[model samples]
Target: MKKIILTLFTAIAVLALAACSSTSGASKDKEITLGATAGPYTDMVNKAIKPSLEKKGYKVKVVEFSDYIQPNLALSKGDLDANLFQHKVYMENFAKEKNLKLSEVVVVPTAPMGLYSNKFKSIEEIKEGSTLAIPNDPVNLARTLIMLKDAGLITIKEDTNQLTASEKDIKDNPKNLNFKPLEAAQLPRAVQSADVAAVPGNFALAAKMDLLDALQLENMPDTYRNRVVVNTKDLESAFAKDIKEVVESKEFEEVIDKEFKGFGKPEWMKK
Candidate 1:
Protein backbone atom coordinates (compact mmCIF):
# COMPACT_ATOMS: atom_id res chain seq x y z
CA MET A 1 0.00 0.00 0.00
CA LYS A 2 2.86 2.40 0.80
CA LYS A 3 4.55 1.57 -2.54
CA ILE A 4 1.28 2.26 -4.37
CA ILE A 5 0.91 5.62 -2.57
CA LEU A 6 4.50 6.64 -3.50
CA THR A 7 3.90 5.70 -7.14
CA LEU A 8 0.75 7.85 -7.23
CA PHE A 9 2.64 10.86 -5.81
CA THR A 10 5.44 10.40 -8.39
CA ALA A 11 2.97 10.27 -11.31
CA ILE A 12 1.24 13.44 -10.06
CA ALA A 13 4.59 15.28 -9.84
CA VAL A 14 5.54 14.20 -13.36
CA LEU A 15 2.18 15.42 -14.75
CA ALA A 16 2.63 18.76 -12.95
CA LEU A 17 6.09 19.19 -14.48
CA ALA A 18 4.74 18.46 -17.97
CA ALA A 19 2.04 21.11 -17.49
CA CYS A 20 4.63 23.65 -16.44
CA SER A 21 6.81 22.82 -19.48
CA SER A 22 3.87 23.34 -21.82
CA THR A 23 3.07 26.71 -20.27
CA SER A 24 6.68 27.83 -20.60
CA GLY A 25 6.71 27.00 -24.34
CA ALA A 26 3.43 28.88 -24.80
CA SER A 27 4.95 31.93 -23.12
CA LYS A 28 8.07 31.75 -25.32
CA ASP A 29 5.96 31.58 -28.47
CA LYS A 30 4.21 34.80 -27.49
CA GLU A 31 7.38 36.79 -28.15
CA ILE A 32 8.31 36.74 -31.87
CA THR A 33 11.29 38.33 -33.62
CA LEU A 34 10.93 38.99 -37.35
CA GLY A 35 13.62 40.33 -39.71
CA ALA A 36 13.12 42.44 -42.86
CA THR A 37 15.07 44.68 -45.22
CA ALA A 38 15.48 48.30 -44.08
CA GLY A 39 12.67 50.03 -45.99
CA PRO A 40 8.98 49.68 -46.86
CA TYR A 41 9.00 46.04 -45.72
CA THR A 42 10.07 47.05 -42.24
CA ASP A 43 7.39 49.74 -42.38
CA MET A 44 4.77 47.19 -43.46
CA VAL A 45 5.53 45.02 -40.43
CA ASN A 46 5.66 47.95 -38.01
CA LYS A 47 2.41 49.59 -39.14
CA ALA A 48 0.30 46.72 -40.47
CA ILE A 49 1.18 43.29 -39.07
CA LYS A 50 2.49 44.23 -35.62
CA PRO A 51 -0.71 45.84 -34.39
CA SER A 52 -2.91 42.86 -35.20
CA LEU A 53 -0.45 40.44 -33.59
CA GLU A 54 -0.18 42.69 -30.53
CA LYS A 55 -3.94 42.59 -30.13
CA LYS A 56 -3.63 38.83 -29.87
CA GLY A 57 -1.10 39.25 -27.00
CA TYR A 58 2.06 38.67 -29.07
CA LYS A 59 5.09 40.88 -28.53
CA VAL A 60 6.45 41.62 -32.01
CA LYS A 61 10.03 42.71 -32.65
CA VAL A 62 11.30 43.61 -36.13
CA VAL A 63 15.02 43.62 -37.00
CA GLU A 64 16.06 45.47 -40.20
CA PHE A 65 18.74 44.05 -42.51
CA SER A 66 20.44 46.22 -45.13
CA ASP A 67 21.68 43.32 -47.28
CA TYR A 68 19.66 40.13 -47.92
CA ILE A 69 22.10 37.45 -46.60
CA GLN A 70 22.12 38.30 -42.89
CA PRO A 71 18.36 37.99 -42.35
CA ASN A 72 18.29 34.37 -43.50
CA LEU A 73 21.47 33.62 -41.55
CA ALA A 74 19.94 35.05 -38.39
CA LEU A 75 16.70 33.14 -38.98
CA SER A 76 18.60 29.87 -39.59
CA LYS A 77 20.62 30.39 -36.41
CA GLY A 78 17.32 30.83 -34.47
CA ASP A 79 18.05 34.46 -33.67
CA LEU A 80 14.85 35.42 -35.50
CA ASP A 81 11.49 33.68 -35.44
CA ALA A 82 10.91 34.73 -39.11
CA ASN A 83 11.90 37.17 -41.86
CA LEU A 84 10.24 39.09 -44.76
CA PHE A 85 12.87 40.33 -47.24
CA GLN A 86 13.04 37.55 -49.86
CA HIS A 87 11.00 36.01 -52.67
CA LYS A 88 10.33 32.28 -53.20
CA VAL A 89 13.20 31.85 -55.66
CA TYR A 90 15.73 33.50 -53.37
CA MET A 91 14.48 31.69 -50.26
CA GLU A 92 14.48 28.23 -51.86
CA ASN A 93 17.85 28.72 -53.50
CA PHE A 94 19.43 30.13 -50.36
CA ALA A 95 18.04 27.32 -48.19
CA LYS A 96 19.30 24.63 -50.55
CA GLU A 97 22.75 26.18 -50.92
CA LYS A 98 23.13 26.84 -47.19
CA ASN A 99 21.50 23.53 -46.16
CA LEU A 100 18.98 25.25 -43.89
CA LYS A 101 15.35 24.30 -43.37
CA LEU A 102 13.04 27.24 -44.07
CA SER A 103 9.48 27.72 -45.28
CA GLU A 104 7.18 30.56 -46.26
CA VAL A 105 4.45 31.49 -43.77
CA VAL A 106 2.60 33.82 -46.20
CA VAL A 107 3.15 35.92 -49.30
CA VAL A 108 2.89 39.69 -48.83
CA PRO A 109 2.26 42.64 -51.16
CA THR A 110 5.53 43.19 -53.05
CA ALA A 111 6.59 46.29 -54.92
CA PRO A 112 7.03 45.57 -58.66
CA MET A 113 10.10 46.33 -60.74
CA GLY A 114 9.63 49.27 -63.12
CA LEU A 115 11.23 50.79 -66.23
CA TYR A 116 11.98 54.41 -65.46
CA SER A 117 13.31 57.02 -67.91
CA ASN A 118 14.06 60.69 -67.62
CA LYS A 119 13.79 61.30 -71.37
CA PHE A 120 11.06 58.93 -72.48
CA LYS A 121 7.52 59.43 -71.20
CA SER A 122 6.37 55.95 -72.33
CA ILE A 123 7.72 52.64 -73.61
CA GLU A 124 6.84 53.68 -77.16
CA GLU A 125 9.05 56.74 -76.86
CA ILE A 126 12.28 54.76 -76.59
CA LYS A 127 14.54 55.61 -79.56
CA GLU A 128 16.86 53.52 -81.72
CA GLY A 129 20.45 53.19 -80.39
CA SER A 130 19.29 54.11 -76.87
CA THR A 131 21.53 52.80 -74.09
CA LEU A 132 19.20 50.82 -71.79
CA ALA A 133 20.33 49.97 -68.25
CA ILE A 134 19.45 46.56 -66.73
CA PRO A 135 20.32 44.62 -63.58
CA ASN A 136 23.85 43.15 -63.56
CA ASP A 137 22.95 40.11 -61.47
CA PRO A 138 21.75 37.07 -63.39
CA VAL A 139 18.35 36.65 -61.66
CA ASN A 140 17.30 40.30 -61.92
CA LEU A 141 19.00 40.64 -65.30
CA ALA A 142 16.68 37.93 -66.67
CA ARG A 143 13.59 39.50 -65.08
CA THR A 144 14.45 43.00 -66.30
CA LEU A 145 15.11 41.67 -69.79
CA ILE A 146 11.66 40.07 -69.78
CA MET A 147 10.14 43.41 -68.85
CA LEU A 148 11.88 44.87 -71.89
CA LYS A 149 10.44 42.09 -74.06
CA ASP A 150 6.94 42.89 -72.77
CA ALA A 151 7.58 46.53 -73.68
CA GLY A 152 8.35 45.40 -77.28
CA LEU A 153 11.96 46.55 -77.07
CA ILE A 154 13.46 43.08 -77.61
CA THR A 155 12.51 39.44 -78.19
CA ILE A 156 14.04 36.56 -76.25
CA LYS A 157 14.85 33.24 -77.94
CA GLU A 158 11.88 30.90 -77.53
CA ASP A 159 14.20 27.98 -76.75
CA THR A 160 15.80 29.87 -73.87
CA ASN A 161 14.68 29.53 -70.28
CA GLN A 162 13.57 33.13 -69.70
CA LEU A 163 14.36 32.82 -66.01
CA THR A 164 18.06 32.75 -66.86
CA ALA A 165 17.92 34.71 -70.13
CA SER A 166 20.42 37.45 -70.94
CA GLU A 167 21.38 39.82 -73.80
CA LYS A 168 23.20 36.93 -75.50
CA ASP A 169 19.87 35.08 -75.77
CA ILE A 170 18.09 37.86 -77.61
CA LYS A 171 16.52 36.67 -80.88
CA ASP A 172 15.43 40.15 -81.92
CA ASN A 173 16.40 43.67 -80.96
CA PRO A 174 14.19 46.10 -82.85
CA LYS A 175 15.66 49.19 -81.26
CA ASN A 176 19.33 48.14 -81.59
CA LEU A 177 19.31 48.96 -77.87
CA ASN A 178 22.67 48.86 -76.11
CA PHE A 179 22.54 46.90 -72.86
CA LYS A 180 24.27 48.35 -69.79
CA PRO A 181 24.20 45.98 -66.82
CA LEU A 182 24.45 47.94 -63.60
CA GLU A 183 23.95 46.88 -59.99
CA ALA A 184 20.28 46.89 -58.89
CA ALA A 185 20.86 49.71 -56.44
CA GLN A 186 22.54 51.88 -59.09
CA LEU A 187 19.71 51.54 -61.64
CA PRO A 188 17.65 54.32 -60.06
CA ARG A 189 20.46 56.83 -60.58
CA ALA A 190 21.18 55.29 -63.97
CA VAL A 191 18.00 56.98 -65.23
CA GLN A 192 19.88 60.31 -65.48
CA SER A 193 22.59 58.77 -67.68
CA ALA A 194 21.06 55.84 -69.52
CA ASP A 195 18.17 56.13 -71.97
CA VAL A 196 16.05 54.00 -69.60
CA ALA A 197 16.81 52.23 -66.31
CA ALA A 198 15.23 49.01 -65.11
CA VAL A 199 14.89 49.57 -61.38
CA PRO A 200 13.57 47.06 -58.86
CA GLY A 201 10.63 48.33 -56.80
CA ASN A 202 12.45 48.40 -53.45
CA PHE A 203 15.33 50.53 -54.78
CA ALA A 204 12.97 52.82 -56.70
CA LEU A 205 10.85 53.50 -53.62
CA ALA A 206 13.94 54.01 -51.46
CA ALA A 207 15.09 56.64 -54.00
CA LYS A 208 11.70 58.45 -53.53
CA MET A 209 10.48 57.61 -57.04
CA ASP A 210 6.75 56.91 -57.43
CA LEU A 211 5.59 53.57 -58.79
CA LEU A 212 2.99 55.08 -61.15
CA ASP A 213 5.68 57.37 -62.52
CA ALA A 214 7.37 54.42 -64.25
CA LEU A 215 6.81 53.74 -67.95
CA GLN A 216 5.91 50.14 -67.05
CA LEU A 217 5.79 47.79 -64.03
CA GLU A 218 6.40 44.07 -64.14
CA ASN A 219 3.40 41.74 -63.64
CA MET A 220 5.18 40.26 -60.65
CA PRO A 221 4.80 36.50 -60.27
CA ASP A 222 4.00 34.55 -57.09
CA THR A 223 7.51 33.13 -57.18
CA TYR A 224 8.90 36.67 -57.31
CA ARG A 225 6.58 38.13 -54.65
CA ASN A 226 7.92 38.71 -51.13
CA ARG A 227 6.78 36.36 -48.35
CA VAL A 228 6.93 35.85 -44.58
CA VAL A 229 9.29 32.93 -43.85
CA VAL A 230 10.07 30.84 -40.77
CA ASN A 231 12.16 27.84 -39.81
CA THR A 232 10.47 24.70 -41.10
CA LYS A 233 10.48 23.22 -37.59
CA ASP A 234 8.19 26.04 -36.41
CA LEU A 235 5.75 25.49 -39.27
CA GLU A 236 3.14 23.97 -36.92
CA SER A 237 3.58 26.41 -34.03
CA ALA A 238 0.59 28.42 -32.77
CA PHE A 239 2.43 31.73 -33.22
CA ALA A 240 3.28 30.89 -36.84
CA LYS A 241 -0.41 30.20 -37.44
CA ASP A 242 -1.25 33.49 -35.73
CA ILE A 243 1.22 35.34 -37.98
CA LYS A 244 -0.49 33.97 -41.10
CA GLU A 245 -3.92 34.81 -39.67
CA VAL A 246 -2.79 38.37 -38.85
CA VAL A 247 -1.51 38.87 -42.41
CA GLU A 248 -4.76 37.49 -43.84
CA SER A 249 -6.83 39.75 -41.60
CA LYS A 250 -8.94 42.48 -43.22
CA GLU A 251 -7.17 45.06 -41.10
CA PHE A 252 -3.84 44.10 -42.66
CA GLU A 253 -5.17 44.74 -46.18
CA GLU A 254 -6.57 48.08 -45.03
CA VAL A 255 -3.09 49.10 -43.91
CA ILE A 256 -1.52 47.93 -47.19
CA ASP A 257 -4.01 49.89 -49.29
CA LYS A 258 -3.58 53.05 -47.23
CA GLU A 259 0.23 53.05 -46.93
CA PHE A 260 1.70 50.90 -49.71
CA LYS A 261 -0.18 52.29 -52.69
CA GLY A 262 0.72 50.96 -56.20
CA PHE A 263 2.44 47.85 -54.81
CA GLY A 264 1.79 44.46 -56.49
CA LYS A 265 -0.36 42.08 -54.42
CA PRO A 266 -0.48 38.30 -54.34
CA GLU A 267 -3.42 36.42 -55.97
CA TRP A 268 -4.79 35.51 -52.52
CA MET A 269 -5.08 39.20 -51.71
CA LYS A 270 -6.84 39.72 -55.06
CA LYS A 271 -9.42 37.11 -54.15
Candidate 2:
Protein backbone atom coordinates (compact mmCIF):
# COMPACT_ATOMS: atom_id res chain seq x y z
CA MET A 1 0.00 0.00 0.00
CA LYS A 2 2.84 2.41 0.95
CA LYS A 3 4.70 1.72 -2.34
CA ILE A 4 1.53 2.26 -4.41
CA ILE A 5 0.85 5.62 -2.68
CA LEU A 6 4.41 6.84 -3.39
CA THR A 7 4.13 5.79 -7.05
CA LEU A 8 0.77 7.61 -7.42
CA PHE A 9 2.26 10.82 -5.93
CA THR A 10 5.23 10.65 -8.34
CA ALA A 11 2.94 10.21 -11.32
CA ILE A 12 0.77 13.20 -10.33
CA ALA A 13 3.81 15.45 -9.88
CA VAL A 14 5.20 14.47 -13.27
CA LEU A 15 1.85 15.15 -14.95
CA ALA A 16 1.56 18.58 -13.34
CA LEU A 17 5.10 19.51 -14.45
CA ALA A 18 4.31 18.40 -18.00
CA ALA A 19 1.10 20.41 -18.03
CA CYS A 20 2.94 23.58 -16.93
CA SER A 21 5.62 23.04 -19.54
CA SER A 22 3.01 22.56 -22.26
CA THR A 23 1.18 25.75 -21.26
CA SER A 24 4.41 27.76 -21.34
CA GLY A 25 5.24 26.41 -24.77
CA ALA A 26 1.79 27.27 -26.10
CA SER A 27 2.04 30.84 -24.78
CA LYS A 28 5.37 31.33 -26.50
CA ASP A 29 4.06 29.86 -29.73
CA LYS A 30 1.19 32.34 -29.84
CA GLU A 31 3.18 35.56 -30.21
CA ILE A 32 6.02 37.10 -32.23
CA THR A 33 7.72 40.45 -31.63
CA LEU A 34 9.03 42.60 -34.45
CA GLY A 35 11.09 45.79 -34.20
CA ALA A 36 11.12 48.67 -36.69
CA THR A 37 11.99 52.34 -36.97
CA ALA A 38 9.39 54.82 -35.66
CA GLY A 39 8.22 56.37 -38.90
CA PRO A 40 6.98 54.73 -42.09
CA TYR A 41 8.29 51.33 -41.14
CA THR A 42 6.22 51.19 -37.96
CA ASP A 43 3.22 52.73 -39.66
CA MET A 44 3.25 50.09 -42.38
CA VAL A 45 3.65 47.32 -39.86
CA ASN A 46 0.72 48.62 -37.84
CA LYS A 47 -1.55 49.59 -40.70
CA ALA A 48 -1.01 46.65 -43.00
CA ILE A 49 1.20 43.80 -41.81
CA LYS A 50 -0.09 43.48 -38.27
CA PRO A 51 -3.74 43.19 -39.26
CA SER A 52 -2.94 40.69 -41.98
CA LEU A 53 -0.75 38.65 -39.65
CA GLU A 54 -3.32 38.68 -36.85
CA LYS A 55 -6.00 37.47 -39.25
CA LYS A 56 -3.70 34.58 -40.10
CA GLY A 57 -3.56 33.62 -36.38
CA TYR A 58 -0.37 35.30 -35.17
CA LYS A 59 -0.19 37.59 -32.19
CA VAL A 60 2.06 40.18 -33.77
CA LYS A 61 3.65 42.81 -31.58
CA VAL A 62 5.38 45.60 -33.44
CA VAL A 63 7.97 47.57 -31.51
CA GLU A 64 9.14 50.97 -32.72
CA PHE A 65 12.55 52.53 -32.11
CA SER A 66 13.59 56.07 -32.98
CA ASP A 67 17.31 55.50 -33.42
CA TYR A 68 18.91 53.32 -36.07
CA ILE A 69 20.88 51.05 -33.71
CA GLN A 70 18.36 49.78 -31.17
CA PRO A 71 16.24 47.54 -33.43
CA ASN A 72 19.23 45.50 -34.59
CA LEU A 73 20.62 45.26 -31.06
CA ALA A 74 17.25 44.06 -29.77
CA LEU A 75 16.95 41.39 -32.46
CA SER A 76 20.51 40.18 -31.79
CA LYS A 77 19.91 39.89 -28.04
CA GLY A 78 16.69 37.86 -28.53
CA ASP A 79 14.50 40.65 -27.15
CA LEU A 80 12.84 40.82 -30.58
CA ASP A 81 11.92 38.03 -32.98
CA ALA A 82 12.93 40.23 -35.93
CA ASN A 83 13.87 43.78 -37.00
CA LEU A 84 13.20 45.93 -40.09
CA PHE A 85 15.43 48.96 -39.88
CA GLN A 86 18.56 48.71 -42.06
CA HIS A 87 19.92 47.96 -45.50
CA LYS A 88 22.11 45.05 -46.58
CA VAL A 89 25.38 46.97 -46.40
CA TYR A 90 24.55 48.45 -43.01
CA MET A 91 23.51 45.04 -41.65
CA GLU A 92 26.64 43.36 -42.97
CA ASN A 93 28.82 46.06 -41.47
CA PHE A 94 27.07 45.87 -38.11
CA ALA A 95 27.31 42.06 -38.00
CA LYS A 96 30.97 42.10 -38.98
CA GLU A 97 31.76 44.70 -36.34
CA LYS A 98 29.70 43.16 -33.53
CA ASN A 99 29.99 39.43 -34.33
CA LEU A 100 26.22 39.19 -34.22
CA LYS A 101 24.35 36.09 -35.50
CA LEU A 102 21.50 37.53 -37.53
CA SER A 103 20.16 37.07 -41.07
CA GLU A 104 17.80 38.89 -43.42
CA VAL A 105 14.46 37.11 -43.52
CA VAL A 106 12.69 39.40 -45.98
CA VAL A 107 13.11 42.74 -47.69
CA VAL A 108 10.40 45.29 -46.87
CA PRO A 109 11.03 48.86 -48.14
CA THR A 110 13.76 51.28 -49.14
CA ALA A 111 14.07 54.86 -47.92
CA PRO A 112 16.32 56.86 -50.21
CA MET A 113 18.43 59.77 -48.96
CA GLY A 114 17.50 63.26 -50.16
CA LEU A 115 18.98 66.74 -49.97
CA TYR A 116 16.48 69.09 -48.26
CA SER A 117 16.35 72.75 -47.31
CA ASN A 118 13.91 75.24 -45.84
CA LYS A 119 15.68 78.30 -47.21
CA PHE A 120 16.56 77.19 -50.71
CA LYS A 121 14.06 76.15 -53.39
CA SER A 122 16.56 74.32 -55.58
CA ILE A 123 20.26 73.56 -56.05
CA GLU A 124 20.51 76.49 -58.44
CA GLU A 125 19.40 78.85 -55.65
CA ILE A 126 21.98 77.68 -53.08
CA LYS A 127 24.30 80.67 -52.87
CA GLU A 128 28.05 80.50 -52.58
CA GLY A 129 29.17 80.24 -48.95
CA SER A 130 25.78 78.78 -47.95
CA THR A 131 26.01 76.21 -45.15
CA LEU A 132 25.07 72.63 -46.16
CA ALA A 133 24.35 70.08 -43.44
CA ILE A 134 25.27 66.43 -44.05
CA PRO A 135 25.19 63.37 -41.85
CA ASN A 136 28.48 62.94 -39.97
CA ASP A 137 28.39 59.11 -40.07
CA PRO A 138 30.96 57.62 -42.39
CA VAL A 139 28.69 55.81 -44.86
CA ASN A 140 26.03 58.54 -45.03
CA LEU A 141 28.56 61.35 -45.26
CA ALA A 142 30.02 59.61 -48.30
CA ARG A 143 26.54 59.23 -49.77
CA THR A 144 25.71 62.90 -49.19
CA LEU A 145 28.98 63.91 -50.86
CA ILE A 146 28.06 61.74 -53.83
CA MET A 147 24.64 63.43 -54.05
CA LEU A 148 26.26 66.85 -53.82
CA LYS A 149 28.66 65.81 -56.55
CA ASP A 150 25.72 64.60 -58.60
CA ALA A 151 24.11 68.00 -58.12
CA GLY A 152 27.29 69.60 -59.51
CA LEU A 153 27.72 71.50 -56.26
CA ILE A 154 31.17 70.00 -55.48
CA THR A 155 33.41 67.16 -56.57
CA ILE A 156 34.78 64.16 -54.67
CA LYS A 157 38.35 62.91 -55.05
CA GLU A 158 38.54 60.73 -58.18
CA ASP A 159 39.89 57.73 -56.27
CA THR A 160 37.37 57.74 -53.38
CA ASN A 161 34.65 55.05 -53.26
CA GLN A 162 31.15 55.01 -51.74
CA LEU A 163 32.31 53.40 -48.47
CA THR A 164 35.04 55.90 -47.72
CA ALA A 165 35.06 59.69 -48.10
CA SER A 166 35.47 62.66 -45.81
CA GLU A 167 35.63 66.41 -45.96
CA LYS A 168 39.16 65.69 -47.05
CA ASP A 169 37.69 63.81 -50.01
CA ILE A 170 36.30 66.95 -51.53
CA LYS A 171 38.42 67.71 -54.59
CA ASP A 172 36.71 70.85 -55.91
CA ASN A 173 34.74 73.36 -53.88
CA PRO A 174 33.42 75.66 -56.59
CA LYS A 175 30.52 76.83 -54.45
CA ASN A 176 32.81 77.54 -51.52
CA LEU A 177 29.81 76.23 -49.57
CA ASN A 178 30.47 75.35 -45.94
CA PHE A 179 29.79 71.62 -45.24
CA LYS A 180 28.46 70.96 -41.76
CA PRO A 181 28.65 67.30 -40.63
CA LEU A 182 25.96 66.50 -38.08
CA GLU A 183 24.20 63.38 -36.76
CA ALA A 184 21.82 61.79 -39.27
CA ALA A 185 18.82 62.29 -37.00
CA GLN A 186 19.75 65.90 -36.42
CA LEU A 187 20.05 66.83 -40.09
CA PRO A 188 16.33 67.56 -40.48
CA ARG A 189 16.35 69.97 -37.58
CA ALA A 190 19.47 71.60 -38.95
CA VAL A 191 17.53 72.44 -42.15
CA GLN A 192 15.88 75.25 -40.19
CA SER A 193 19.22 76.57 -39.02
CA ALA A 194 21.43 75.81 -42.03
CA ASP A 195 21.03 77.11 -45.52
CA VAL A 196 20.61 73.55 -46.82
CA ALA A 197 20.49 70.06 -45.32
CA ALA A 198 20.94 66.58 -46.73
CA VAL A 199 18.46 64.34 -44.92
CA PRO A 200 17.42 60.73 -45.22
CA GLY A 201 13.95 60.39 -46.78
CA ASN A 202 12.42 58.67 -43.79
CA PHE A 203 13.60 61.31 -41.34
CA ALA A 204 12.55 64.11 -43.63
CA LEU A 205 9.09 62.57 -43.98
CA ALA A 206 8.84 62.09 -40.23
CA ALA A 207 9.65 65.75 -39.69
CA LYS A 208 6.84 66.62 -42.18
CA MET A 209 9.50 68.29 -44.33
CA ASP A 210 8.75 68.15 -48.04
CA LEU A 211 11.19 66.37 -50.34
CA LEU A 212 9.79 68.19 -53.42
CA ASP A 213 12.00 71.07 -52.33
CA ALA A 214 15.09 68.85 -52.07
CA LEU A 215 17.99 70.12 -54.17
CA GLN A 216 18.71 66.49 -55.01
CA LEU A 217 17.52 62.98 -54.13
CA GLU A 218 19.34 59.73 -54.58
CA ASN A 219 17.78 57.53 -57.27
CA MET A 220 17.59 54.28 -55.33
CA PRO A 221 16.18 51.10 -56.81
CA ASP A 222 12.45 50.61 -56.35
CA THR A 223 12.18 47.69 -53.92
CA TYR A 224 13.28 46.06 -50.67
CA ARG A 225 16.97 46.71 -50.49
CA ASN A 226 16.53 46.91 -46.74
CA ARG A 227 15.05 43.86 -45.02
CA VAL A 228 13.52 42.22 -42.01
CA VAL A 229 16.37 40.71 -40.01
CA VAL A 230 15.91 37.72 -37.70
CA ASN A 231 17.90 35.42 -35.50
CA THR A 232 19.40 32.53 -37.43
CA LYS A 233 17.46 30.16 -35.20
CA ASP A 234 14.10 31.77 -35.95
CA LEU A 235 14.50 32.10 -39.70
CA GLU A 236 12.08 29.26 -40.44
CA SER A 237 9.34 30.26 -38.00
CA ALA A 238 5.77 30.21 -39.25
CA PHE A 239 5.16 33.67 -37.85
CA ALA A 240 8.16 34.95 -39.73
CA LYS A 241 6.73 33.51 -42.93
CA ASP A 242 3.41 35.24 -42.28
CA ILE A 243 5.16 38.54 -41.63
CA LYS A 244 7.10 38.22 -44.84
CA GLU A 245 3.99 37.42 -46.82
CA VAL A 246 2.15 40.42 -45.51
CA VAL A 247 5.07 42.73 -46.27
CA GLU A 248 5.48 41.30 -49.74
CA SER A 249 1.77 41.24 -50.60
CA LYS A 250 -0.05 43.63 -52.92
CA GLU A 251 -1.93 45.15 -50.02
CA PHE A 252 1.29 46.24 -48.45
CA GLU A 253 2.52 47.40 -51.85
CA GLU A 254 -0.36 49.87 -52.05
CA VAL A 255 0.43 51.14 -48.56
CA ILE A 256 4.09 51.76 -49.45
CA ASP A 257 3.23 53.62 -52.63
CA LYS A 258 0.64 55.86 -50.99
CA GLU A 259 2.48 56.44 -47.71
CA PHE A 260 6.07 56.89 -48.88
CA LYS A 261 5.09 59.20 -51.75
CA GLY A 262 7.68 57.82 -54.20
CA PHE A 263 10.51 57.87 -51.68
CA GLY A 264 10.28 54.06 -51.58
CA LYS A 265 8.48 51.04 -53.00
CA PRO A 266 7.77 47.56 -51.68
CA GLU A 267 10.71 45.34 -52.46
CA TRP A 268 8.55 42.40 -53.44
CA MET A 269 6.36 44.52 -55.67
CA LYS A 270 9.26 46.17 -57.50
CA LYS A 271 10.60 44.48 -60.60
Best candidate (score: lDDT): 1
Best by TM-score: 1
Segments in model 2 whose C-alpha atoms lie over 4 Å from true places: 1-30, 221-225, 266-269
Q: Native-vs-model 2 lDDT?
A: 0.79
lDDT of 1 by residue, 84-172 (tens): 98999999999999999999999999999999999999999889999989999998988888888888888988888867888789989
| Model 1: worst 10 consecutive residues (lDDT sum) | 23-32
lDDT of 1: 0.92
Task: List the lowest-lDDT window of 10 residues for candidate 2.
Answer: 217-226
